[model samples]
Target chain A: MSDNTGTKVKGQSCRLPRKRFYRARAHSNPLSDSHFPIPICPAEFDYSHHYPYFFPSGGEDHKNGSASPRKVRFADIGCGFGGLLVSLSRLFPDTLMLGMELRDKVTEYVKERILALRASNPGQYENISVVRTNSMKYLPNYFGKAQLSKMFFLFPDPHFKEKNHRRRVISLQLLDEYAYALELGGIIYTMTDVEELGDWMRSCLEDHPLFEAVSEEELEADPVVKLLTSATEEGQKVARNGGQTFRAIFRRIKFEEE
Target chain B: MEETAEFVSNAGEDSASVAAVTMDVDNGLIEDDKSKDAEVAPALIAVHPFEKSVAVAVGFELRLFDLEGNCSVSLVDDSGGPSHSDAIRAIKFGANGRLFASAGDDKLVKIWATNPWHCIRTVSAEKRVSAVAISHNGHYVAFADKFGLVWLIGLEGDNAKQSNNDKKAVMILGHYCSIITRLEFSPDDRFIASADRDFKIRVTVFPKQSLKGAHEIQSFCLGHTDFVSCLAFAYPSGCANGYLLSGSGDSTVRLWDFISGVLLATCEVGAKVGSLEPNGTEDAQSPISDLCASSDGSIIAVALQYSNRVALLSCDFSNGNLSVAKVVTLEENYFPTSLGSSSLSKCLWMVMGASNLPMPGSAQLPTRLRIISGLRKDPSDYHCHDPIILEDNEVPGGQKLLSELQGSLDVTKEEAALAAAAAAVKASMRNMMIKKEYTLERREMRKKNRNDRKIK
Candidate 1:
């Protein structure tokens, strides 16, 4: 149908605008900017309507006054078609998960897909929900710092231009945000068919102050890593098109006891 | 910190939200505890685990504290939220106080986590929820709304919202248009008892897993002329052996054998006791707002709507007799909304909602609800202040007034009146006039002053 998913943004990282949620068009400014600015913090973001159970965002915990009613531990960033989210839902049935997408139409598709699955399975998919927002711009508004245990960056757009490198999903500044939202031992999973983009994400996390490269043996042990090869639509498309996909996983370094 | 949650009961936490009732300590009787703070709105109190408890109130402002003095987490504070933005109609704790659930006028049912006291799951209904009941297993929460439907949601299953099919409800039972005001699962969780505003209580068999037997009505508790507001097991902590006690708007508390659907005893607590019954109103102070039975099934507490009083009765399930043991009077202008009792500590907890400051001259605004609990053996030893302590005493405990329990003296007269009305509905007013009304025909004969008086 219509690809209203990506809008051409002007100024900074890369001058030639083909498509970007990753790189800026101008080198002067590399920070991701959205025309729709979000709230300063989560208190301004009401998520009651988005949750399956009564999250009473308006109603704080009655037992202890200060505790948040709930915390979102699973997040799927740039969840294009929500394929990974839907697939990963079965793997972590008890976990409350959320998907943040940039396009309204795609987000609607994910919601409808989730709704259909829920209706078919009754009381099953409520743990997973989707919202339409640019994760790079408003991730903190949805998840509290150190609230997430696992995050997925599956098959994000590969901005090939050398000048547009800063626009990639896994970049220097965004790594700090990712590290902030994840627990000390939390894992960040990145998968892409483009080897160069995969390498970019690997080096970005490697150089981040709060992150350390996960061992290959440890990566092999994670159940979620299995889905990286065949879960998302883009991953499946890459596999069907005879393209080699790459995976890079990193762990938050501080406060990790083991 | 390792939290060692001792055996906790369902009475609830301290402090309150909307429309709270408190007992003042001056006379060792219930006194209205007014809101010293202006920001708190009104809320609802949840009846819970029959063991030792911490009263939990979710409302305009929320308050949760231990009534038994063993609050490992010490969750007492003046806070808001964890309640419906509008009003919370009912809240009940699951079996051992492991789970808590509340229904609000917002048509939302929130199942809360107890240790931390947060709403973990929110279930939406088609109508404003009237009552909430947790299953004996503490896993399923049964709720009824303004609409006549009964919904059962399993708390342990995948979130009700995620299921592909409408698997959230184990089964749904209903009455035509009457609102279901209370729901209770038998101690065995085999049968679910439901009460409606239309003066009906239906007990339906709860199938082990599926709701296939939901349509199989076990029995019906009838005979109330007004709405039945609350129900409690005759033996709350026992085997639930086919006996239940119900309180109604007709200002009567009745004991029934659920298996036979027969009325056992009807104890009158009405106009004779100053219930402030409103003329021609079907639902008002005349209705029993809340009722509970002690674990041993020896005592049942009745709180009348707007009566501002709690009547403790000695219940004999064997002969189906209910005798008023004591009438705990709340002095001052106070409104009693809910009553809870813990069998473990034999503590009777009452929640009262007061609106004004009770000053020399102050405007009446429905301010706050207070929660107080007292040891049943010695009612005077009750505490309404020092909320977190067993001295649930915020004020003086309510004074005990010894009064003879009024037997069903009004039953025959009320039955006759009900029969007359039933006939009136069947025949026209003209037909009824021609048929000779009972009081009217006698009145005419008496006015004539015939030799009938000489014969008598």
Candidate 2:
């Protein structure tokens, strides 16, 4: 870790390294920063690959205008490689989906996959998109407060050491961000194979202000249990290992008092 | 403050360095004596407490952490193989901590004894055990499972072989159309409270020295509109009249009169209360995520939905005042899932998100247990120079702020947006014209300097 002074270089505070840009039209990457400081290109909108048809419009309150038929119902946070999102989008055809990933390469890969899937099934193509941003900071920007019905926390990095616990995704601070993004009575779906992680999630959700565990009995009975058991990319791996999977669902609770 | 913290971290290169520093401040002999005493007391107290403790009970793995000098020591790892064909759902200590029991999804309840964590017996329940509790005297164990059946098992005697042979569960089926979520034994060991999905709390009185019949239903506490998710009887320590805290699907944690089935107070966490399903129907919103009452009954900590913020409230039950004393808000990614409190100190530990496994699947995140020891109450320190009162309107006031924002802010409202954009462009163009005209007028007066420039 750099010192705070080092963090404050020039006028920027820990400015991220500039992203490399490649030109598809020119079929070349910029070779000189001095001469080709800024690339000039017309912004193109192509939904053929990802959404060849019109977006869905059948959400309950879409009475005003017909924007698109594709309605986003599910989203995966930190979607790496786009494998899970693509699989889930196909599984839940009626529910529009999204994958928000921080890594540019992964996000690009997911977007490409969504596009390819859209090309094949143009009619059902509006169900997905990948956003590039740190999930923790961009949650409020990406989804309205309580806009998401279901949020997925796949295999998040576990900052295990005692001092590094704060860096872990499941902390008292991060749950608030999740709560804001999740719809009231909506669910935040999470699965982790690490016993400690599973326990951490259970403890966090069970103790979080926004959610309550859909008791072990209720969890078994819910229809979503099928998706939890078999659909998720992570769920299948746990099963193959003959590893015992600990699953718990936390439903957003409503405030009872005025 | 950051610099000072960094200095401190750098100063202590290792634990030995810390010890050396401590000895420099205090006499080496006195420090050694304190350290020696601290290490030995836990062993002395271990004999008197629960013989075998189950710390982490999930799936097939049951990890027990013993309470040492202000910390818990994991004992399950030390004594291996408390085997079950499936995961373990619930675990409890009985026989004054001598007898330990665990049950799981595979519908088998396995019993064990301590000294060395070892499986002693197995009690088979027809259904899966979802929750478990032990009597104060450690003679009787109570459990509720998937079939909504509550069972009372009596520990025959201290003789290991005889106890293993006579292990029997007296099953009492009563909950209708819903699975049981939580089952807990009252401090006195006379009453057991079981919460289920039907929103009804079943309290049972155990008959002494008997597993022959069934647990007599003492009372049925009912009020919550949704499923009863969690139930906690206040730890018996700093208060009288044990307070029973229950978290429900209604998003509210209600305090019961412990024995009388009377609703003392209800703490509504986040908005969504009174609604269970969000199909735009009347029954879709509920607020409470989960709730934990402090051991002394002075504080009830509730995890609120929407923001996943944990609200620590001071309970002035006599005055019917449940004031928001303090709030610890977490981010959106991590869900504050489960909460457990230490039997010794009022230390609170919570499991955060599930473990993160590598590759093709989602590995459940490790349960992060946090020990929230009571904040030192210094009345003198309460008065600060600056008190920032957060505006209620900034964040959702117990409501789903995201939904409210989404409902109001429609990005696709092009007609209204187009008009706003046109107006903004007009304003910007007018400002630009003014600046351009002003600059053009000034440039003409200074133009002669370039034309009349000297050759040099």
Candidate 3:
């Protein structure tokens, strides 16, 4: 196969050159056009005295040593506004799911949704969360390698204009980040409304040495994929307006660097 | 070096001296006695109160610091194989710290055995695993991912036949257009409480015998206007209130009776909370990043992210009232707060600070637990420093903070070698050429422009 750079990709799905990979940048205060201005947490929340629990330390002992292995299986990358997050929690009640988003507004929105979910279904929705974080910057922060069984990027900003492509959430550089974050056999599931953006994501995943397509049939037939089609806020919008929603699933393949 | 210092109480011009005091981090003690007199109080961040140690996730690793700063600090490596390659988002220490559970973007919820942290088992997920909360008895490990999926893993049966079996992934899904942010098992282990982005709290009662879903929708706590960031059950320390406090993007920590779904009290903090205008209208603010209550539920700590402060208030549930007791100022760079404390650990709560440390040179991203220790001292006793909530906030408050965390630095041997290799490569490509300066006059003109704007 030709390198991403060697090929002048015709569409968004084909792999682009490494140079086309997103160059991570800080978010601009995009103009918010809303009736009530979205609330944001104080920038300097005084943690001066409180300690943040980075690791498990409380009363989490398995009463039965034979109990379930303490393990996590699913992940969300750049979970914006957490629309998909709420959907996934109900779809896979037994599988642990995590939502990673960069914006505080988005994460906070998800937080309220989670608390309410837990309040209503204390038994079922207690296993989900939307963490406030820049996914591109912190994939390894929350998870261990090969730890995830699946990952998703749904309708992430395309950074459409050329100069802003570097700011796009998905790119060759981010592909490596995902590749390392995922376990062997783990899958990366992505969806985009823009065909060009879909091509961009496809190219990013396809070009990486570690990932290969899970087959079109597998992508279409997966039950979890149904949740993407039926439950997402954007999915509803796509259905209503007759907009196209393209999705691709890539599994991590074994690779030897040496 | 002193930047501009703001005061909670208007003292005299000499207040600048009080603000200038730096922490004597080496001695595990505050060097200045006079600065202690300042009224600026400390607020709680994230609280993870375990039995032996109160664990906090800062950046790449989890810091298992002492609850009272009297014991030795323990560190756990949260890096995912590569150098600084993992973010420790949610960490829960097993009973007696024998086994600990952690989850992050790596999509793996790893259960580590004690002493030398070894990954004994892992719960693999399809997406970034954001939150992991093991039951008090550790029978079920509940985890939520970015996709808003909640998974209940029953540890009772792990027959090898189940190995390599996709059948193990039993997921419960529902909740449209929102992400699940935080989840916790009720004190009895019979129920679970979860918070999501949609500003709703759901309670599910589990079956008595089996770890399977009880399918019982008990009640919904429906008052938060924005995402609820943190949720905690009333610690069963003689408190029969059965209350649940939720921190939200609305900048208020609302207390709810989990069983009845009644709004108990809303502890407001920051400009948004005080924004009750002269005309009784104010601009709304973001949700509280973190929340923690005392054992008796007398005091609740709210960590305000954009507000740049932490506030402690008295929660008078009997009358549904809240009064701000004190607010502590924090450094400007910190964001995304975490809070933790135990039943007796109420007077002092942990706050995780300066979580997202932009890598000094690169634009690469970061993790769940990037922590800094001893950023603030408990004002009641200045000599007593407590752990802040950042997961890496594991170090003891004073002298041993760095030494204790020396074991869990996210850097790996392979990554260290790669760093050395990269350094060598860069050295080989070095070009010794000095650039010309634009001249002192130009620099001064730029500085003057910035200063003029500040004056305005």
TM-score of each: 0.43, 0.41, 0.44
Each candidate's lDDT (Cα)? 0.58, 0.50, 0.53
Scored against the native two-chain complex, candidate 2 gets a DockQ of 0.02
For candidate 1, lDDT tens digit of each residue in B1-456? 001011011012211111111101111111222223221212245444654344434342234444344332333212223335555667777778877776766777777777566666666776767778888787778888654567878766553445523444543566433457789887778788998755667776676552332544556676675667788875534544658888877778888888756778988865434554223233333556678776566667777654545677777777677777666665333445566655453555554432112222222222223343443454555444312212212322211100000011122323332222222221221121111223455435432443323444
State residue A84's C-alpha deviation in candidate 3, in Å: 31
The superposed Cα distance between candidate 3 and the true structure at residue B201, in angstroms, equals 0.6
> Which candidate number maximizes TM-score?
3
Candidate whose lDDT is highest: 1
- Per residue, candidate 3 scores C-alpha lDDT tens digits across B1-456 of 132223212121111221211111111122332232111111112333443454555444555555454455544445332222355567766534555677775677776655564555666777666567777776667788754557766655562246432435445432221346778777677677777765667675655433333334345676776667788776534555577888876677887877766677876664534422113344346446567665456557666544445676666666666667666544333332455554445334434322233224323222222333343346789657543434434434533443333222342322332232222211211110011123366434433434223443
For candidate 1, give the lDDT of residue B257.
80
Model 2 CAPRI rating:
incorrect
Off by over 4 Å in 2: A1-258, B1-54, B64-82, B92-100, B112-114, B156-166, B235-240, B272-289, B304-307, B354-365, B375-456
lDDT of 3 at A125: 61
- lDDT of each residue in B48-156, candidate 2, tens digit only: 1322232543335444444333233333422233356664555555536666667766677666666566665567777666677777777766777654567776665
**iRMSD for every model:** 28.6, 26.6, 19.9
Candidate 3, residue B93: the lDDT equals 61
Positional deviation of residue B68's Cα in model 3 after best superposition, in angstroms = 11
- Deviation in Å, model 3, residue A178 alpha carbon: 37
